[model samples]
Target: MPDNQNPNYEIKTIVEIFKQENLTIPEYQRPYKWTVKNTNQLIDDILLHQEKSKYRLGTMVVHNNNGELEIVDGQQRFITILLIAKVLSDSNFLDKDISYFLTHLKFSNTISHKNIARNYQAVISRASDIVNEKFAKFFSERCEMVQIILKSESEAFQFFDSQNARGKDLEPHDLLKAFHLREMNDSDSSEKIAVVSQWENIKSEDLAELFALYLYPIRQWSKRQSARYFSKSDIDIFKGINLKKSPAYPYAQILRMLESFTQHYKNSPDRLFDNQEVNFPFQLSQTMIDGRHFFDMVSYYQNSKNKLFNRLKENEQTNRIISTLDNQEYKYRTGDKYVRRLFDSAVFCYWDKFGLIEIEKAVKVIFLWAYQIRLTQQSVFIESIDNHARKDLMLFNKIYEATHPKEITQLLVNFKIESKAKNSESVINLAKEFQGIKNEK
Candidate 1:
């Protein structure tokens, strides 16, 4: 390959550069990701420049030796800049200092900074056969291909990375979003609308964070099971799918799922402060599991004439128990069969039979007790999840004892809190009382 040091390089305008063909990203490269906030910030930066006496022109480095011009860096800024240029395309601003500032800037990077730059320089130097002919049209006036004579592809890449590091960072989600958007560009407007719908209003940065957290599992699963790594591209696609599917959340098995969601929302309060975003404060309630009373309740519900407990137990077993790791644990758990049967025996009395939502809450309550039993084996006060689980356990037994005539009335002979039907309400019900929504509007 010829050396890339002696090619014509200059700065150009948004109208002068064309995206011609997209440079391929390597397997090791991170994804293109940006949140709404980041996108907004870029726009704001351009607007800020326009407000000043002179417009700020960002550097767009291009290697034009090949049939197709490759963009080694500045993809996000380039796009954002394009958006600004488009907005101001016909305005007087186009010929003003702002436009002049944007159009006449040159960007240069040498391979000395990094090995990749050397490779990039080489590719540019021998672009005649290095790049595909089909994408050559993209290097036209639209992108203002300010051809930079670099030594090699490595040189170009190092410049790209360094230049980008000095400005805004590219994220996996932004790239994914860009890819999807570009892929959909050729489709009908209606179809394109659907694609855009998938690109929610999350800031590009927040989107990246969310993608990192959620895609971790899928990434691991893919790598471990397939013995192949997943690209940010793969993760980006999977994230769209996950957003669509609304994957079931088993709070007990993976509290991280719940916690991650909360953490992101908390971190970006600007986005989440509104009632629509996160109205309900997430709480993990803890309840006490009176071993004897619980076992007895299980037995009574299993054999009760009313058959309330059996139905609840059955629901719990089929819905919750089998879904847990312990159920599959080779160490302790036996068969889910007996558990399901026993759970079935409790269904009639369990709150779930009354309503699905209520049942979900009830499962949490029961799980709190089970979690306590697990923790009791380890230590008191289950420190991992705050005191939520412990509190739930205490409340469950409290409510159970209060509701059960003989149990609470007799047990309370020596206890402090009185157990009575009126007093044995679920915490949720008590919360309603506290909210004072007694008489609905």
Candidate 2:
């Protein structure tokens, strides 16, 4: 591509190319990193100049290179204009007089005015593929794309990359984006995390917003920059706590934070800083955890559970199931196979970790097995079993896994129950007996 020292170009609205292929941001060219603040400023500039130029001058700086005007520094601004135009179009704000002026406002309109005007519709037709809808319609009624000459696509791409990277100070998420895009080929498991993968699918602007909401809290928590960096280990610790137990669901944490932020600035939508927006109420101090840490904790918990469930499901290794007793908590009823596996695992964890006395463990196990089988089997004779045995069994089952039948024999041997066959029946048979008991009572 020929590099023009002072590339002469004409301004075109982005809406003019609405149907054009999104120029695959060349691998060398970084993704769009402009902040909302920067975009808002560009809008200010465009509005100020457009008002001064009577919307006829169309104060856009387009460089002439090859097929289209290569918008090096103004792509985001052009995009914003298109968005504004869309809003205006949806509102039916554009008049016929304004449209007519936009149709003939291109460089070709002044160059090969007559010949270009003849094929103006065709050129605008192609140009509309890349142009924004609002600006394209605005220009179509006035000047046409046939009025503009060809420009080099490569030169435009190069200019856009060089100028944009130099102008903006990228945020943490921006750097993370660049890192991910550059090292997407990495083999690290952390890199393969679902949270990171999901981040890759969204726009850089959205990613930055998420990062800011979460990272800003870390900044507050730390005395050093290194401490401000949120890591997988920190998130892992938070997730462990979450799995242990909580009054609220994991998602509630982030939603709670957003609600807090929104409430803090409800009166002043324009303010960026919380202090500038309003006096932040210090109520419910417990809810004031850092947004990033809280979100990461929840994300890690959800992602880990997802990973474990998927892994187990794929391997058909769901040996220990602890299904919900009711539908309210998104629980499913437990099947017999699931119950047995879960009981075995719970005994393992409790016996190995908590070191319950052997006699106590046996007493607990037998009682639990009897009660569970009765509950599931609907046994009628459960009332005939000693009340103490029933109570101990229920308590033990709650504290550990009640699914494993092996625990029953272990309990019988430890308690040294002389009459093993006295109360002994298959859980299914006991269930039948329990049902009869229920009818009798």
Candidate 3:
């Protein structure tokens, strides 16, 4: 294995990569995962950029094992290009490395074989027009990729991890994990491994929901910003001050202060016999602390959000309020669902702030605030729900600034319940139960 300090990597046409050596698929590589949609996307991308002198397709990493270039990444794109060459037919003129790929390529996974066959048909239908030599040569000679050739498979994998982590297919949470992990450079290696392993053990969809449904909206709403969309661009919200590189700003100092106290409390000698473990008090709406705290905060809040429902269930009044909203006729409408999300988000942050203190009233206040938008508007949209989130008193803003439960739970917004709105008159009358306000109609 050569020193990975400087791996051999450079720009190469698809032809150069293929012709260099026998492109072998490593055992670790997942079966070719490209689908018809992915293939069509590649074709459209190729067509869109064919006129350029050189279009950098993307990156590929290969482990050069005894001259056999084992593909550590870009297997999907590599195979798709070969399939394109095969469709353009008599393409021996363009490059023969891809021919070796087509003739010898085998997949043990049935899904791979199925998708390969499906994408083959797609290419035939899409690439038949490129039967002429010009387009074929352009694909073979003009399109380039950054081909990273590492000496060992481990080096190849390391290179692949560094490059492919930011790929288009990743969700925002995945990006956040990568970022925070990088920030944990000074942390204990074992703790870093444990956090990442624990994170990966979770279902991907749940992590996505944690960020998009709860964390993102709550963060934005607390700042009095619209959060209808949570995308890669908004990940900076979770990435707070990197303490290693941070100045002594009071906000950053507060997180540092809490970190010191929590660590001392947990590591204090009394913990062993008493089992009085103290976790860093993580407020969902608080300014984020960087690195391990970010990961710990994520794991904590995820479990906290799940446990909150059970906590709510423990209280009869909160249960009754929840039951009331759940039984509403408009419960399943898109607007109604958004309204419920609004309620749940507020409940999540409220409980985070006050530990279910007067949670029944807290939930009722949130319910009235959220569901009122649904009852008052004939058609509630993402915008309406988001706007209503910060409308007037701004419920999240109230929760953020308040030191007491009543500051949020007791706060009320006055808007006439529109009886003409789509929600059954029954949902409108729930205000009477929730807040003692009757529909003006």
Candidate 4:
């Protein structure tokens, strides 16, 4: 248990937080990513517990960076409650004092700004009739948060991780946001805000889905390994470059060089206002930071021209292969549930590196290899086949980087499985089809 004597925290009610204290969302914090569903659920929860004398919302870990209280955890909940307050104030449901306090509340410009506004309005519209002065009074007075204020930034994050592990875990992306944001602590406010906006603009669900379905799998495949479930630790894979720790920390060396040059150039500098060292405040480009770079990569993957389905719409050969796979008559089930994830990984890798130039050949080879494995190996459990296919595809991808389809086909054929003869036959047919495509090209 943390030391109680010097916890440096106090329990604050909604009214107290708004009336007495000034709160700021740290630049490291992700923008408001809560959806309307989350907003409605919170409202419902508050309403459900309104009968009680006091309701505890939960814990919020904050850091007292000098005098400014930077929220480290419970950002989602904090923003949601602020939205509730906004609704109450707008509807004239809150007391004059509380409403005035809410009026002074400020929010940083985050990517989820529009969504937050939309959801706030929705809450107001939904509770227009039900929320009155009495309801607002109860909320401000009764709803409480155990605000734990820590002295150091590291302590705040440790507290956050410990609490999240015990309680309802935040999504992996949320953790990544926090981690990356911490790295940007010294960055200019505008840089932090811009990165937060880009990070939040990508829907939370889409970010999670992309990592789980495509990015994670492709990464694993490149290493000649089967993709496993994504976890918080996997966030490191997406973190492309660590700006702070890198030797080429773009500005630090240059700043030092500039300072030295300036000192040498001036023998006796004019005694200007209060001999304070001149500080250079500059924002690094997004590409310099890991968090921003990761988001940029995700954006690229999502909108890249060489994307499989996007290419399918324009390329007849690509469409034909996909069509054949989708056709029910061929027993090539492309149903949502039955879609081979391995093929998705393959397409992502091929497109990410090579683009549309050789996309047809790549897609056709991947689909046929995947299709044949799916067709012939029935007796073996589906899970085991999936595991094997991932490994085979992983190996094929690595070898394919240096060689062509023939070598990739040979690598795929090497995987030992049930019904070897049938698998071999399928591979032969695929090779023939692949050769015909190459011949035509």
Per model, state how many residue pairs clash: 78, 53, 0, 0
Q: After superposition, how far is residue 120 of candidate 4 from its true place, in Å?
A: 4.5
Model 1 — TM-score against the truth?
Answer: 0.28
State in Å the error of residue 159, model 1: 4.8
**The best candidate in terms of TM-score:** 4
Candidate 3 lDDT by residue in tens digits, 1-441: 445457787999867766765778753245566889999888888888887899888877877878888776788898888788787655445645455666666665555778889998888787556666777888878888988778865566556555646577768886677677657756675676577656755677999988888998988898899899888778889977776778888778778888889989989999988998778888877777787888788888888888998778778878876776677566777877887888888888788788867888787778778877777778878898789887756888888889988787668766776765654666667677565654565
Worst 10 residues of 2 by lDDT: 317-326
Please give, for residues 270-342, the per-residue lDDT of candidate 2 as tens digits: 5645546432322111232332233333343233333543443343212112222112321232333333333
How well does model 2 score by local distance difference test?
0.35
Clashes of 2: 53
Note the residue pairs that clash in candidate 3. none
Maximum-lDDT candidate: 3
Error of 3 at 28 (Å): 16
What's the true lDDT of residue 240 in model 2? 19
lDDT of 4 by residue, 104-205 (tens): 444565455677787877787768544787679888888899888888776777667656655555777776676666666677878877777776667777
User: Higher-TM-score candidate among 2 and 3?
Assistant: 3
Please, what are the lDDT tens digits per residue for candidate 1 over residues 134-164? Answer: 2222222223434454545445654554444
Off by over 4 Å in 2: 1-8, 13-51, 54-75, 95-158, 171-441
TM-score of 4: 0.70
TM-score, ranked from best to worst: 4, 3, 1, 2
